[model samples]
Target: LMVLGLIGAVVLASGSLIKAISMIILGLLLGQINTDVISGTPRYSFDIPELTDGIGFVVIAMGVFGFGEIIANLGMPAEHREVFTKKVKGLWPTKEDFKEAWPAVLRGTGIGSLLGVLPGGGALLASFAAYTLEKKVAKDPSKFGRGAIQGVAGPESANNAGAQTSFIPMLTLGIPPNAVMALMVGAMTIKGIQPGPQVMSSNPTLFWGLIASMWVGNLMLVILNLPLIGIWIKLLTVPYRFLFPAIVVFCCIGTYTLNNSSFDVYMTALFAVIGYVFYKLKCEPAPLLLGFILGPMMEENLRRALLLSRGDWSTFATRPLSAGLLIAAAIMIITVILPGISGKREAAFQEAD
Candidate 1:
């Protein structure tokens, strides 16, 4: 899974291998700086006691995206507003649009199903890859990003499919592919339930019930959204001052509920400021959250693998299957530097991004 994810990143990078390498190094550093619970040592705590617990992923995400989004929106002039269609029209797509979208949706579903099984691959990557694939396959690729129905339908379907299949790894293998699945694992642990292959055999009702709920949830969402879309649009038309405070209040409540810790609330406030700064600098906060969530797990696994191999670093490359995956990832990275391919890859990404 890691190899697959690395290959995806490499392919996506085009000629930007240096940037990819730096981002990885940064993630590794963040992971290492986090406190090791078993060792009870803080690597980058900077003599601050609050740092010992390490920064929470939920806090950072809320701060960077939730609060930061509100802050950024608030910075824009109040009179500036989103342009919306003045009239309400039928929700269904036209016949030509439907025809174009169905094939894209089917292709997206297939792509999402395959990628969702990989660790670290989730709805985001599935949507991204699907959109890219759709653009590549489209008869009029130039239509993408300018009210392209295929662009919307393909990614939306892929994300939904990816989200559903992501549960497979979590339920059957006790491995979470993303942060949400990690939370699901924690929730299962809290309920005195172990998640794995045994979950299906030992608790048939719970397993089947969960599976049924996904369909029910999808139906409910469609029914609810149809009526509420107008209300949502109306809410979007509301002034930022009126809306952002409500968002901030909800974020604070959610942050405090994490451990009922006022300290977390305070930390969230600090991160809100940091998030705003990042927003002003046009920096992305998503990778930091990913690093925070995946870092410790990566470190723990690396440590265990090394210990099992008696500290022999060659184990990663010595195994046949492992070597093949590594070689594939390496090849993808190397290809990004090739002359014509690099230019075209960069152009594709530049268009997409």
Candidate 2:
């Protein structure tokens, strides 16, 4: 599934398959840093204690998506770098917009709810999947990546639904599905509330309260943000010269505070340079990020399966579910790589350009 997401990102988001693949490889290499979880041996730590623990996702993400983008924007011509400061009107969607968006929202919500329960599946993956699914199902797929209403509605809905459903595993099974849930688990522990099946019966108030809070929080966001849209838009009017520095400073501070380590700050800076290089190369970082997240999990699961099968390589194909997924992946790969389909895909994506 992760592989499929990465491939889709490369195909849909990044036009250059080779560049995206190279970035994914680079991410996989970076993911190899720190001690091997299975063998307890360091792979790419270079004898540094900080590297031994592996790089934090926050460091990579902030560097790549935040700092890197600032750098990219700074490099662009002044005219090209200007923010969209046009006058706003019609904050509400039209009836036709709702008609088109409702179906997409429903599909996105269903996809997100299902994916969110899986380990390592969260809002990011769900949003990407939903967006890709929308493109796949759209009457004129070329309308995507432009001003398509479905593009915005589907991903936003998916993201919210995925975020809400991600708590299920954490609350019911005492397993944190993602980093946020891990923090929630810690907080619950600190509060003397044990997570798991017993929590619903033993601490019904907390369990039910949390569920109720989700709905209330959603309503609060809608209430607060709708009125504040103009204010949010006004922020874009701020000069890039002032805005960029503040963004960089805050991001550095946030990265430093993540582990209270200067090493992470330095790592973030290093990745920022890498991200800038990626920007110059026109290589989309999203697939790389996905690869980095999924690489370790893939390795761990593969090792576990091998261990269970006593080193039998055929174990993957021997299992019906695993075989089906593998076959599906293979078909997707073939479909994307075929000359006829690849040419049409390129032409379709070219419309966005």
TM-score (all chains, Cα) for each model: 0.72, 0.86
Q: For model 2, give the 10-residue run with minimal summed lDDT.
A: 5-14
**What tens digits encode model 2's per-residue C-alpha lDDT throughout 1-353?**
55555565556553566776787777777787868888899888888988887888789989998888888889889876656657767767789999999999998998789667766657777776788678766777667655699988998899999998999998899999888999999999999999998999999999889899999999999999889878987777787887889999999999999889999999899889888988788676776776777777677778898999999999888889888877877787788889998887667655544
Model 2, position 11: C-alpha lDDT score = 60
- Looking at model 2, the pairs that clash are none
Tens digits of per-residue lDDT, candidate 1, 221-325, equal 889987876776676555566777888898899989987887778878877887798667544454444444456765777788888999999999999877887
Whole-model Cα lDDT per candidate? 0.72, 0.81
| Model 1: residue 290 alpha-carbon error in angstroms | 3.2
